[model samples]
Target: MHDPAPMPEVQNDEEVPLLGAQRLGFSAGSQRLIRDIDLTIRAGSRTVIMGANGSGKSLLLRLLHGLIPPTEGHVEWCERPLDTAARNEQAMVFQRPVMMRRSVAANLRFALSARGIRGAERAAREAEAIASARLEHLVNRPARVLSGGEQQRLAMARALACAPRLLFLDEPTASLDPASTHAIEQIIDQAHDDGVTIVLVTHDAGQARRMGQDLVFLDAGRIVETGPVAQVLDAPSSAAAQAWLGGRLYLDPTHSSQT
Candidate 1:
């Protein structure tokens, strides 16, 4: 089959902020979920966050994305706090998308409307997003009732419709079939080519190897190893990461709780 067309670059109003966390920490009551995270996400990088379950991968993503407030540290973008302006330039997609009860087309329209695009302009944006996601046939279907793969495509389409400069995805293909996963990865690649900085969290090591330029490996709420994809995955610097990559770092079931 021919390669899928890349997404056309759409320049945003301003550049994506250089995201960084300074001494970041987050606690859930007495349990510290993340601790002392000092990291920088440079502009135009495809950064992937990977770790064992309960190792603070998701928590760190949420904290950095400004979805949850940090307990003892701060996150900033472009030397400023992660306030409304910074947040406005970002978008996120979760594993299981929560869709509106309306039709697929209406759901996408809602996202565009929220971004202040309306009338014929909204229609054009929606059309483009739908075509990119290959959701034309599903336009009139109820969004929530579509199959899992279709719902995910719609969710990604809706997020992309807003023209975000930064995109965060948390295990977006965690439960997808092979074909569906491939579709999602292509969409992600197109977004990256279009100048959207991407940060993704995934447990699938192969997925990380395929999509990541930079790798961040976490263990017990700390960054055990981080570097370029091949370096960290091939020549791990930490025992924990080595153990993980070697498939010997399995945790007990009783301690199973997500980060």
Candidate 2:
């Protein structure tokens, strides 16, 4: 019922635990989806990944989460490798979440318990996550059969249930209805305020602006631009970035950007 501790003060130029990439590239067999990308999102900051589908936005998040190993360079969270500790410190929510075939409460319990949560503390944390997403009514429902929107909220709840330091979201609101999307975004903002550094991938400009302090624009396996969202959107550095924001879609969202 009680809110968690307030987010710590994060001043620019202050030493922060960063989720960083230096010339990181992701390859599949021989296909490289991202290349020569250097990015550093400060701890407790909110960053967005914006681009047309298959611009390597999702892949880049995976690489950052250590779901996929980079073919070149490396990703680090605060100078440490994305080992178990780092992975535990970070959590990712996908557009279509991978869900457990259990009640929503059970799913939360499974995830949080895996993170070593227990006792009244775990119950409080689970309730907090559900309440934060405004999903208290659905906590006892079957997680698998939930509507697309509710499912997404549960995914978010599961992610937040761990109280991770870093959160990665790959179009978390893409399939939800507007109200559900709004709810999810609100919870995301709350999460940001709670001191979890965020890397959010989305095509929705409005969501990006609301949630992102900075943006990374990717196209054809390359980073077209990286800067404050206001700067990058208002004055895109490249024609590709311009076209990307204009919704002239060129990349496929289905396959890896190999060519």
Candidate 3:
């Protein structure tokens, strides 16, 4: 097939409707993973979604990314429905890096190619991504054989190579060492600076404090509270949020500070 044409650019900051979810919910059989999640990711906002392990943080990210369909309600970007065109302008990194059975450099090249990038431009992007991830020495190494931290960095760089306008990360540094975590954080910061809107899901309070401009706290599949990071993290109006920040995990709403 011939090269895919470029997607029309979002005209301006205002044109970027960002991400919006209305009455979003997801259920498997009789159990609901997420419910009534009404949220909006603003243009260029470093929004962090925080909750306990089973609070559906990862599921929520997948729902918004359109990787999974919501059992109820809808998701939108740039005021348009979440469809192929919208998804094409975004990228996602999961908690566990999923690498192809190929060299690190080759993996990045594939990601770029999928986005219709080729020729000298593709090589340039692949080179820059490799350098950014500090994987110059591992260029020809098989991706799946890299150390855990190295694989995660390669995953991040691959997503960045797509030149996405929106980025969704589901605890990308969850199991990484402090140094590796810091490197990923720096890459995220640079992506935001380069005009990528970020939505991150993490349980690490320290990460939230360092990168969150806004916070959305979830408990038992519901948003307990949301506001500027300082307000929500420091002075949460919801007792459930306070307790979670205090290291208390409650899967049952009745067990939460707020009923």
Best by lDDT: 3
Better of 1 and 3 by TM-score: 3
Which residue runs of candidate 2 sit more than 4 Å off their true CA positions? 1-15, 249-259
lDDT of 3 by residue, 66-178 (tens): 99999998999877899998999999999999999999999999999888999999999999999999999999999999988999999999999998989999999989999
Per-residue alpha-carbon lDDT of candidate 1 for residues 1-259, written as tens digits (9 for 90 to 100): 1121122121223445478888888888777778778777777888898888778888899898899999988999878999988887889999998899999999998889887899999999999999999999989999988989899999999998999888999999999999999999999999999988889999888899888888888776767677778888998766667778898865523233333
- When sorted by lDDT, best at the front, the candidate numbers are 3, 1, 2
TM-score of each: 0.89, 0.89, 0.90
lDDT of 1 at 121: 90
Which has the greatest TM-score? 3
**Residue runs of model 1 more than 4 Å from their true location after superposition:** 1-17, 250-259
Every candidate's lDDT:
0.83, 0.81, 0.84
C-alpha RMSD of each candidate structure in angstroms: 8.1, 7.8, 8.5
